[model samples]
Target: MTSHTWRLQPEGTAHDDRYDARADCHRRLRGPYTGLGTLLRSLVPDAHRARPELVAHHAVEILSAAPELKDLIGAGPQTLTSLAVPNERTRLYPAKRTRRLAHGIIEFLHGHARERGHALALRFDRVDEADHTDQEFLAILLRRALPDLVMVTVHTGGTDLIPELTTTLAAHATHTIAQHPDEHEDLTDNHKLALAYVESDGTSHDPAEQAAYRRVDAAERARLHDQRAAELRRSGDWSLCLGAIPYHLEHGSDREAAADAFLEAAEYLVSMGFYHSLLDVAGRGTALMDPAEEPRKYWMLGTKVTTALAILGRPEEAERRYIELRAMFDQPMLHIFSGYALAMLYTRYYPAEQKDHQLAKAHLNNVLAMASLLPDHDQRVFQSVFNRNGLALVELQLGNPTEALRLVSTGLADIDRELPAEKHRLHRSVLVHNRGRVYTALGRLEEALADIDTVIELDPNYPDYYFDRADVRRRMGDLPGALADYSESITFAAPFWEMHYNRADLRLELGDLAGAIADLGYVLELEPDELDARINLASLLREQDDAAGSLAQIEEGLRHHPGDARLLCARGLLALDAGADQAALRDFDLALNAEPDLVSALANRAALVLETGDHRTAVADLTRALAIEADNPDLLYNRGYVHQSAGDWESASRDYTAALLLPGADRADLLRHRAECHLALGDPTAHQADLAAAESAASSPNAAADPVRS
Candidate 1:
């Protein structure tokens, strides 16, 4: 029989006979096989690397010439390799000692078969010491070597399939061939012969192994880190990359192996969208991967950064890392996570210097420009949960609130709710919290509340939920409810400026002036830029007759938001109360100019105008105020006073009439004011009617007379 091409890959240490036999097989046949002579003519791992096809042809021509067993090796115009062989038990796992070696040889042979069809051949192993009937072992080896091939195996030992190998191969492999559980007391000798024949015949095979299958752990079984590294270095084959990395990672063949392993994982992760698993295995993926992977890399990097920033307290370094990741990734979700890291980094430990946004943007833009090439669906869905989370945050940052909500909702929908209880709770809580934020931003307060409430129910321990939900409740006018939530938030995130400010607002509403003032003070301490808190604190102090504190608060607030209209208005009103009309006038004028329809500003300035003897301008201000809020008692009464001063009795009477229609009309106050106006106009009878009405209504529920300080 003629021999077939066979590449000799030395196994074990350099001195072993087994290793020598492998090397001898190739060198001895070098001159005999013309195909090998042509193939082995070139070099490898160099400028003259030989082609696999050439090497294969040469191997075939030489190996067929002098086979010790012609029965197992042949070079007929047949389908397989250049030889035909029979199944043998010796090669069937090779009796343990040779099992690993047998696996390697078989694997390489099958790989040759895949690279060049009918140019390689192998023998199959059988169970029951029976002839090889296309055994499952053969099929598994083929699938690993050439996944597209169709082959089958027989399982004589009745049991359920274990799919550890299914991870590397197909999920399913074969069916039971042992017809009866009782061995054959039920079948005659003739029936037994049929079983034997069928067992010895080739039956099951599939080109596409989509169905489930039994696993075979040959790769792991044959694992030898040192041997594999030596082979890879010699073969210079790219296909061996997976095996090499695992060897380095699992064993660290040498000191350099650990670093090499990390580099390989990094490259793989960078190539595979920076998959979270690769990151988990790599220890700190951000330290290894390039930022060009965009959202994927940013997310993985964010976790490392968050962990480092929180523990090591290297906020400056954290910010720098954040910038690098942001440069490579511009997705909204990435922005959010990185934002959280950077925010925490700065909030807990601010940098002595500012960030580098301009440089950061250029890098991030590169990622965006590349990511934009992917279809919209690619942006809508990410393969990894980390990437998906990053994508959602990116949507939030970019003002795509609708998309952000959709992504968060979809993300939660895709998860199995019955997972590890704590893990599930954490995931659900995070999802709901994020969704709540998006909804609130969209002004869908009811929807936002539902999400926030779910998050709170799922994990009340998380602080941001309380603070965030408190903000929503406040917006919905649930002051007491908002206060409760804010209080809880402060309990969890005691130092947060947002929670303090929100609670302060609720405290003011509940008439807790001291609590409100205290909260506001803390808020300013946390974030000096909080003008609203400062103003609110001043206003509350003024209500409590703390003139000095009130003025001090106003001045403090102005230091931060100097041009704030609300601050100006509040300050002007306080100045007026202190009888500093000129100071008040300056503020009110500026306030009104900032917001022309400011009711309090217009009204205050109207009185100031009167004090300055600008009757025409004061009338104009009062008339405009009444137009803005006709039902406001102060505006109506003030406008009437302006009209009366102008001797416009018709306008003055109209204003008094409108004021009397307001809630809790203050019958005594209205009648007294109106009676005076009528007397001034020389209407005695009208004044008499007004006096009668005033005396009767003064003690009634319709009356409440007290000056309201502006």
Candidate 2:
């Protein structure tokens, strides 16, 4: 098999400021996955052939995040509505979404390659100017996809790509080419030049074209924008609204139309979880209008931007913008909306040290007060219940589970009493879900399970509700039920590594070691840098006597997380198991230096030192390990053995006595050791009592071998 190359060149140039070049390409191509889908369709012309459902599943997954593609994908109204519903229970972060997309694409490619013995090559130009969503998708695809299945050549405008994309190119690209620009064409016709620029969605980097386009009068340029926007609107491809339509209208003659387009796009992007894009488009819309004159439109855009800021981890900026907007707009609805947003910012998005539940509660109260002032009684009731759900979350975060439960109950009651069952279905589901969470926190597992079950019935398509129900079932000791729920969750969504990770633990608990291993391996495939999954997988592989697999996992984890203490300690234990004592000692020392209080490293190192007859060092290591695990009988027993070996009878006697007092202690051995120590310390009465206890324990059926000796 010949190895294919993927090239990326990110070039920086002037006159590329109008729009994101790569995003424009994406819009023109319909979506990020369209090329792959087209290739698959070409490979198998019959729509029934080659698992088209897989392709459609992934297409739906991408559409869920970028719903503007509904027109291009021919998604039905019901399908679009289902995909558009915001999943409040689980926040699928951008990176995870990228990983899921990459996984789905690779799966599709592999299936195609299996049936049709052929490889595909794809190229993308101006990748540096791609939007965050496209860049992240390309970066993950480059890193994870097999080279033989698909070769990607990315011609970045410059080397100014995002850090992740740049790193992926540097590490994965097979060849790098630097090409100098040729002489620019003499474009004397201003009309032709401006047309070319607009037709390309402002992706023209030609200096001559740029200069000619700039020479065109503003009236003509606005006329061109208006024409382009009308053309895109007539094309019936909604995805263009995310890019070309909005870009054209923003530069069009009508400022109000531009603001309206941007506001619509902002709301669409926000729902799609494209917060960075939402922030940009919303800011542009805000710039085109005055807050004082267009307060409602301005507040709508401003609130979306504020939400984007908070979701993007800029809480301070979000807070500042919220305050600025609130001061500018005195409307009750503005206060209600912005107030709820600010409350969520404090309750969820703020840094841990900066989070203030009391402050969040105050904001929620303000939202409720504003809601009451609304003229419409139904609006007041709906807003009150909606904001009260947030207040419940704040109370939960404040460690007031009872109060949170009460708040959730009141919200549910109001929704049921005041609103029709069909009204506010989404919010009703949210309240039920929040109530479930509160019940779980309050240790009311049955109630939590009931609430989760109800929410799952209400919104059966959402995966997080199943995951949440699984958790409650797990806590309720319904292992089989929890396992089924977890499987159902995985089935409902694309690929949630977290659900797999949790299910792996559940499988392990149920003694399905193979299932646990498979789930953990899948988790690593979805997220390679998942250190906890790596560690658990390594340990599980070792349990199954696959030492090589375990070592590979540890090495791979170390490659990502060098000097990680848990990994190092695990490596040390593996080395010791293989009789590489010096290597084990070195790794243990390194692990300890990285984390001094690492109990496992300390205890294992104590064992190694004891083997070398370093009794004092062994005793010191065990003593420190004991500090971290005060009630550990094994550590106490080991320390007693080391002290006894060092001829420290008093210390040995104290340690042995402590070990005997612990639950599940090796009673016969501990008693015998304590009797010997007591005799050595000349405590005749204590020695006699311990000797009698030792004899009695040895005869007991429940007695086991000494852990220290074993």
Candidate 3:
């Protein structure tokens, strides 16, 4: 019991964080299944988390505001109530389901906190007032060994408890405290003082009273800002001094010092990912500098501002400023820097209509030339390798994967030559990962896996690396390995939908229809307009004899895409399964009308017509289907059935023999059917041989089953 920890504290309901945290956790675990693709349904729920690179890419979108970053953001505004994972839709053990939900929630929140560099605190402040189900959830959470999880519970006195919760608390209780009024009052006072000092006023306030009670008029407040700026300058903390610059400027405190602080702060913020703040400082800092006296300072501030604009997704403004900077500054380094930033805008973040890879390549080549002329050898090498990395990305965007891989490989070699082992570790990781991506695109799984393995060893915490490896393993046919990688990705980033979609596909391949269906359903929930997931789910349901479920799903899809040929074809399948032959025929007719070349609809309607003793109509349908798919065994076999029913033994036998020669042929069934045709034609020798072959085929361990494929 000591292995688990549980604490009971009674507090106001409004203060409880557990419910909100639990709700968020459930959403993460359940969100990805909304629009499952056929392939992704096989993975565990964890793989549903967002990959790290996508998240980083999204961060750029937020900082840059560039509307043209072409990537699937998510399944927007879809929900799980209308669609769900198969397990949730079906009846499951209450205890097991609850435990999974609870554990998944904990893991989801933990991963989120880890990625954002924050602490996770799960506080159930008034458990005694909660319902039995919630109480059970708390108990289950306490029982698990969650890493870095802070679990706190509150139980008010005189409240009834469920037996399981009572037993859980008795065994795992860590502490029970009776807080004193004076101690509580002192704690409240400290909180008030801290809030007043920071939130209420960070500068000049009345020193006659305690910090918490200090107040000031507008003039006094302005004086306080000036005073705080002076204090920060005296303290000599560059970072804090920079933070105070805005306040000092507003109060008209030391214009020269404030301008210096602005330049330093903007540079510092660039490294810390405060792109927006960098723009603010650079914008005002340039205005403060006298261009005639300090042209260099003005140029530096302008360049910084331009780069910030580029990174923030304002390519037009950045390009304009870059042109201005080039005209104003003669420094080669500034030109190279501007060229590099502009190149990235065209390569990675350009609007689709504005994409120009040739221009991007030209800019990158300019960087290469400028860097080659640098006095320092190490600096030149570093810049060259960096440009090569960008060029590799541009080649990838241009659909030259082999060229991309070659460039990235060359870049890595340059890094090895120029930088020490510790100096370019991050760049090395990126280069290896990029090379792996190219390998995956080339369908070279072994090489791809090797590169990804190296990447993971270098940076195991990155979720996207795991996602890349999972895809490589899937392509290699190592389903278990792929699934493991997907799970690892979820452990790092819990809001990714692609992982769920991929896992669902793997599960289907492994014959886990229930798991596959669940994943597909979840995918549909995530992406309601995902037609592939809808079709796959309906198809799987038909296999499970869930014709009504299959029909309902198809109908829902039809509502979204009225008269869609594919959905109509799927509906026809469901109607056939339900034994509504007339309705099936009508659906097939409608489907074929929507898409005249739909082979399945033609073949299936032919089979239905043959059953009605209309051989000529069936033959016409089969011939049309066969014309579209000449080697289709199912079409050939169905046509043979029509000929055999009409007493055309020679034609039937010829068609059956042709079907048997193809792959996925049902040998036992074909042989027996051919024997019937031979017997009808009075060919004793052929009939006897076919009968023997059928018997042997049925007796064999690798016996071919009947071709009942839809």
Candidate 4:
């Protein structure tokens, strides 16, 4: 059997035996794999730096030995590099190239091993320290499962592996080894806890382990700082700055430098849409800093932490951090940033009565007031533009669509005039998206669609753009297009309950009842206590004639919200339909007691009263309902029938006349009732006129016949 063995590096240390074996194996395979060791050595602390080139160079060298694989290697160096270059028009994910490289390597290795009639064994020790790009590559390679190759990978276990890496290793690793040391061994408390953390797979609940884990984190962070510094000094690559933050924080050796690194990295990560990582970096960095000594850095770190928390759906934590950061910041720029973050949180997460769009508007106004005091930088103007967009969103949320549109338009004009095109693309795109949302709210679907199209051109992968466009498409009656755009939004960022709910609603409108039911059911599964989703599912079930399923859904909702008037009313309606008059009456009473002005409950209870021959009580309920909605034709018609039955001809005539004047009134029925009333009141001419009008309005012979007098 032909095989190769290599060990991956552990953080803060090296294993010499595995290193020696790697070197020996690459040196022995001099024809093609000579520089494999050199290629591995070139991996820097920054995972994003020229990874594709390294992988491609290694593949090229390997292909030089096997002429049969030349076609697979492609035409030239430019071709290999071009493979790394993503199509900007296609909205490529950041990790796409890493995955591509992994697949390419797997294909090459499998073909080579197969041609040689032997499987190759490759071992990676201490794989935990591999940067994100390398980890992705490893994951894809393992998932591909090349038949002619055997691969082994080892992780240091204490480090928090990304989800993809952890899943890949857990699913594919064939063997495991425990390197846990004896408790009595002469080790530091941090080291002992680190071992325990590793043993328990980071779920150790021991109090000692918890205490040790913090120190271990600090130590590891410091080690990372040392590693990043050394790598940067050798390679002169500045992008490794982000990877150095935790380490610098751990050591507290350079307060200003660490703070600067943290702020820069946090902003870069934010642009890359890595909110979770931004939170980690900002949180760790803020904990290590002295606020008085590094106020600017502290403010920036805290602000970023708040922003990340808000974006990651932790509004309460974001609010707390923002308030603390706001108290610490006397600087105008920091105030603007943190205030805007708070404004967005309030707009999205706060209760309707508690929402502070006015506060958001005030912050933007303050930023504008201080604009002349600031330097003439594009970033300053960009912040102003962003704040205006925030205000527009707040306005939209507050139901001031016209004001929202005006703000978005003025902000777009300000960005065009005050900032250079390249400097404000992101802000402009966002403002355009806000404008689209405003247009959507104002019922201007075509204009909204146009603005969303522009936004998509600027930032196609942004999920909200797709969602907004999906809404526009839905309003425009493009059901398939709306569904596709909704799916696209989910593809970009999945499991959004709002998107699922909206799509289910659209599907129901388009008569895809099963699809609508499935989407609604999935939403309930994700959030079991979602009352609106439960109600919607129940309604859909009833429409499909599944009354039992519908009742079960309403009961489930009642379990979560016992006094919910809407659920009670729904259950009551179902009971009335099933001839459970007592149960129906009880449910309606409960619903009305909880919510006295519930129109549906009032109307339904009146119908139930009419069924039980209590004409006076039925008339009273209908009268109360009509007082609430005086022009409601159904209320008018129902009350007229009750009055006519009780021999009150004049009252019946008044109700019938009112019903006839309302749009969508059953004209033939209303006229016939009025003719009967005229006859009872001994008016021959009025009766004859109504009878003629009723006959003309009626389309059928039976309907044309005069309504029988009670």
Candidate 5:
């Protein structure tokens, strides 16, 4: 048995071009799963030939999503049509797509593994420069793949990686620092070393090579950069435009070309929802040109920077940049862009106390005003509709559903009347989607469903439309319809944890317990620290009488979220079930200390204390629990029993009367308890009447026992 060692470079080393060029590249421009594509080629160079069934079954679908793989495996039929189309409006989130690619790669690896007697060792280099999608894929692979299949190592160049990947690596991988050999002898010829560095697309991490390159004169360095940029350009690799070209151009003498390349990369990243990458590229572009000299490019980059900032939840920074742009350029388009960005900041991204819908509306109004100043008629109309859609969101947040509906309707009407249906299809869908949300808020279920259905028809490949329709159906009490729509959404884009989480809830409602459990387990697989999913999974496991599984889930959730009141309460309930009364009581105390109003903890603690004959404490806990759930018949009945136990006849009578008024209350039990209380109070007439009522209720077929502390 021979063990294979594969020295992979996430951002390739000096000798590699394809992997280096693909670093930080947007998936839309180069297609997704490039990292997995490289891995597949390395692992099984003739995978299609070696494992035709596997390629036909698993690799084809992934290759369809990643066209770059077509050259490696030979292009096949478009099996996953939903993922094949590269529409910015209908694409899955980067994480979701990465998960799908990871699944396919795991399957491919497992298939390859069966032929090998020993596990392969994978060494990933320069992971710090890898794209977020690649990082996400690697993280998922590390977490989900069997350890016996592959041994993995990562080199991060002493830089901080994304938190999730870093955490996963910390837990699953051994940590070691690499010590480079002394290379001072190699720095003697600076010019030759610099040339070699440039030829390598500047991917060298050797200290001596870097020192030699820096020793070269600035003009010579610029010449080298220009040469490297030209070579990359002549390579005709589109991904190089995003990675090596922009980098070399920025360092070269061509400032204008650098700005252009950065702008192009930023736009691609924006379309791909790589907001963090967009911010970096847009910032570089903004630095290359002056707002006054090249106002269009400079402000275009500025707008992208601000938009990315807002989306990334740095609204304050976005607001400051927008203000600076507004001060520098008073152009109508700049104002319109800035105004909309500021409006969205307030409407969606700002902290709760800082959120001001009125201010957002004011900004949108300014945007609408600027729309009229546009020279082109189409531009004017499109800007008007776009800003009006934003205004609809602001109005919706402002608690004016009617106004929001009017705004969305007006925007849709403008699109229909003035613009061609094909011109702004994405924006048109957005307007209709907004109308659906407005309709949902107004309790117009049928109208909401109709609007969502229209959008789904218009853009059937978009997963969110199906998710929206599913929610609407769920709200309309159509569980089967909602479940079908949720399944459709999952089919279009798998590994979206929210869709799986929601589908689990619907499955539970439909009594598909196994399906619900599978969905929840999948959700946890995709997002381990999803607290709600963990809590729900634990509760469901408990319901299924899987005590060990339920306890394990609770412990895992507690590990992730220490002192979480809900998990603590759940743990307490598990303890109570296991007859660990003291442990249950302690957990209830801790949970209530964390959250005073946790009703489950209070109710369970009340039952435990009542069993211990602490009538005062039991009454107090039940009273507190009742405050949170005033209509709960169980709490009322339990409290009435506690008061009767403590010899408070009048209070017991009052509580029994209150419980009898609620639906599902045991009429005979309440009547009997109240009759005892009345007798204790020396009210013979009332006692006799209550006894008669209790006798009649007990004789009825609907009567049943209602135990205390139920």
Candidate 6:
């Protein structure tokens, strides 16, 4: 053990020389190993390494342009669309995907640390030399990509080295875009060099950086890209600018219709370098055009025109342009946009009659069409916006409040996302109101109350939201809440005719008949054609037995919204109360003609028809009413009365039996009717049993409170 060391003395001199040179090479090459250190140094030069990928990476972030941008920039004197870049492609999935991709790259770097930061640098050329450790390269990439908060500053040039030249360029462009959130948002290919200043101590800077960022020679840059940039350049000239100014007297740029024409003129003026015309357009409107979009691709010009008209309450003009643009190219997105526009137009004015119904249906159909067209990755986006609103409208139109409530609540539950967030928070607020309406109709007080609360939290300014909520609160027997919401709604915007009418109805509910009458008076003054308000006011007057006053109100309302179905229905109800059966029947028939599917009209008409001895016609009307709301206690009782009056005791007994299974029905009365049927059929035992069961069920107040509602 003590003599284990072996001597390496060579026996021959010549043999020793060969071994010396070989060992010297080995000593030089091995950093620690010996030999060939100089040989390795000759091939691998580390100090001048370049990292272009870092620059490109930053370029990608800073230059994302809108898909429609090229057209705007190259509009060739058509005027630029100045809305600027479309927002970034955002989705919740990105959050999930980023963490996983980062984790994998990070783990890979841990295994090969020598090439850590260098590995992420994008390489455009072939490499024939030995490389750094994979772990090192991977670490380098992970460092470049780790989000700002977590990623430390990367020193690519060792302790003293600034980031590569390309990285500096990328950082500049990125920093500029970051500083100016309003402009430089679109990260398109052309804006690549603009991101060089994202991070700096203001020490090491690139000579090419200023050259790239300067827009002083925009004309030259345009020429650099050949005719496309030239086209963008040509559109910014003065000749086209002159035509942009409005020369008309009278209806000047201040008018909404003229405003649209003024914007179109601006496009011409800006393109032709007509600064004077640009000034005129600016005088007419507040929003400015972008110089970048010199030849401006006419902006969402169609969208703007339609929106302006809709705002001005000119649905005819809005619809014309909406249709014109919609037909230019047939895509499902157009349907969503058009339908939304139409729905807004109708909703804003509070359309009545068949037009409101038609618009509502069209709106829903458009949403469905949009859903059908969405890409797989994007399908959930529209769902997040429209699911509750469109479905609730369809449900209300179909008169299935329970089904509507169930579906809409479910839709709200599924809107799960995070971070940058969904852009339609305002629209979602509207959906909350829509759901509240459904719940109100279904008489789900507590659930409806919760939804209305959320709607207020989302948007207090939306006109219809408050009215819908007030209606819900009134149904919940909260008179104070209902009154407050109604008052708040009208206070915010007096042009909302419906809120005035709603407040009036709430006043009547609170039994302040005078107050209700006064509110209705105000509503009618603003909207003389509001038949519902007039009818309600008339009914309230009639309730106070001021028949003359009621009759006068009805006549005046009818004069304005002449022969409205709701008015006829109200007048008929009044006549029936006045014991004018013949007159009541005539009025009900007229009401049905105006709105055939009106449940109140059908039920009232059927009762009149039955009393008039037309049992066959009475039964048909009752049957259809039952189809609409089979669970309506009044409708069911009326149908039973029809059958009994028609001399069909057996059929009459069945109708009464069905009525007993629904809400608000007098179980004792049903038993008596059924017993009468049994007596007529000589069934004493059946009659006795019916009498006992009805009395027992009605004896319990708790039992009576719940309905057999089937």
| Candidate 5 deviant stretches above 4 angstroms | 1-67, 70-121, 129-133, 183-188, 663-668, 684-710
- TM-scores for every candidate against the unseen true structure: 0.42, 0.90, 0.54, 0.63, 0.87, 0.44
* Candidates by TM-score, descending order: 2, 5, 4, 3, 6, 1
Native-vs-model 2 lDDT? 0.76
lDDT of 2 by residue, 1-710 (tens): 11222453233322222211122334323333323333333433332255556546556454544444444444522322254344222232442455565566566555565555644445655565666666676787787767666556666545656788777777877554565654555767778977888876776776777777788999999999899889889977666777777788878899999899888787667665667677778888899998777889998898888887887789999999989988887888888888988898889999999998889999999889889888988888988888888888888888888998888899889989998876767777778888889889989999899999988777787778889999999998999999999998766676768999999999999999999999999898877889999999999998888889999999999988999999998898889889999999999999999999999899999988998999988988888999889998988988988888889988988898888888878988888898888888888899999889989999999887667421
Model 3 residue 270 lDDT score? 48
In model 4, the Cα lDDT at residue 577 comes to 77
lDDT of 3 by residue, 1-710 (tens): 01122453323323344421222111111111111110112211222354544333233211111111113333212222112332122111212223333444444444554554544444443344333334555564454424243344443332465576676577555545453222112434543553344322243232322443344444554555566566556754333433444445444446676677677766554443344546766788888878767777777788778766766678888888888878877788777777877887788666888878989999999898998999988778877877888888888889998898899899899889777876656667778888898898888889989999998887766677888898889888888998889878866543345667787888888888888888888767544557888888888898898988888999989976799888898888887877888988999999999998888888888888888899998889889988998888877888888899999988899989999898877788888889999999999899999999999989998886778745
Estimate candidate 4's alpha-carbon lDDT, on a 0 to 1 scale.
0.64
Superior by TM-score: candidate 1 or candidate 2: 2
Give the per-residue lDDT digits (tens) of candidate 1, residues 1-710. Answer: 11112111122312122210111111111111111112212211111132344323222222222222122233312211111122100011111111122233233344444444432212211122211111222323433443232122322222222232222123333322333332223333443333232222212122111111112132432333344455445654332332233333344234345445444544432232212223343444333434453346435645543443443345565677677667766666566446544543433345436443333333344444444454544332222332344456655655677877787777676543323333333444566778788889999999999988987776655566778888898899887888888777644321456667777767877888789889988767545566777877787888888888888887777766776777789889888888888889999998888888888888888888887678899888877876888778877878777787778887787778888888855667777778878888899899999999888887776468664625
> Using alpha carbons, what is the TM-score of model 2?
0.90
Give candidate 6 misplaced runs (Cα > 4 Å). 1-261, 264-294, 300-302, 309-478, 508-511, 593-617, 694-710
lDDT of 5 by residue, 1-710 (tens): 11111233223333222331122223222323335444554555555667776665564445533434556666543222232323313222341444565665665665666656544556555566566656776777677656565555555665546787877776665565655554434447888888877765676656677878988999999999998889878866555666678888888998988988998877666655556657767887888997788998889889888877877778899999999998998777888878988998898889999999999999999889889879998788888988888898888887899998998898789878997666766677778888998999999999999999988877776677889888999999998999999988765553468888999999999999999999999889877889999999999999899989999999999988999999999999899889999999999999999999998899889889988999989999999999999998778888998999989998999999998998888899889899999999999999999999999999999886665452
The Cα error of candidate 5 at residue 662, in Å, is 3.5
Name the runs in model 1 displaced over 4 angstroms: 1-427, 430-453, 468-482, 563-571, 586-598, 626-631, 659-668, 671-709
Error at 320, model 3, angstroms:
11
Taking the tens digit of each residue's C-alpha lDDT, what string does model 6 give over 138-232? 23333333332122122121112123323322332121111212223334333343223211111113434433545325544333333222343
The clash numbers for all candidates, in the given order, read 26, 8, 36, 2, 0, 63
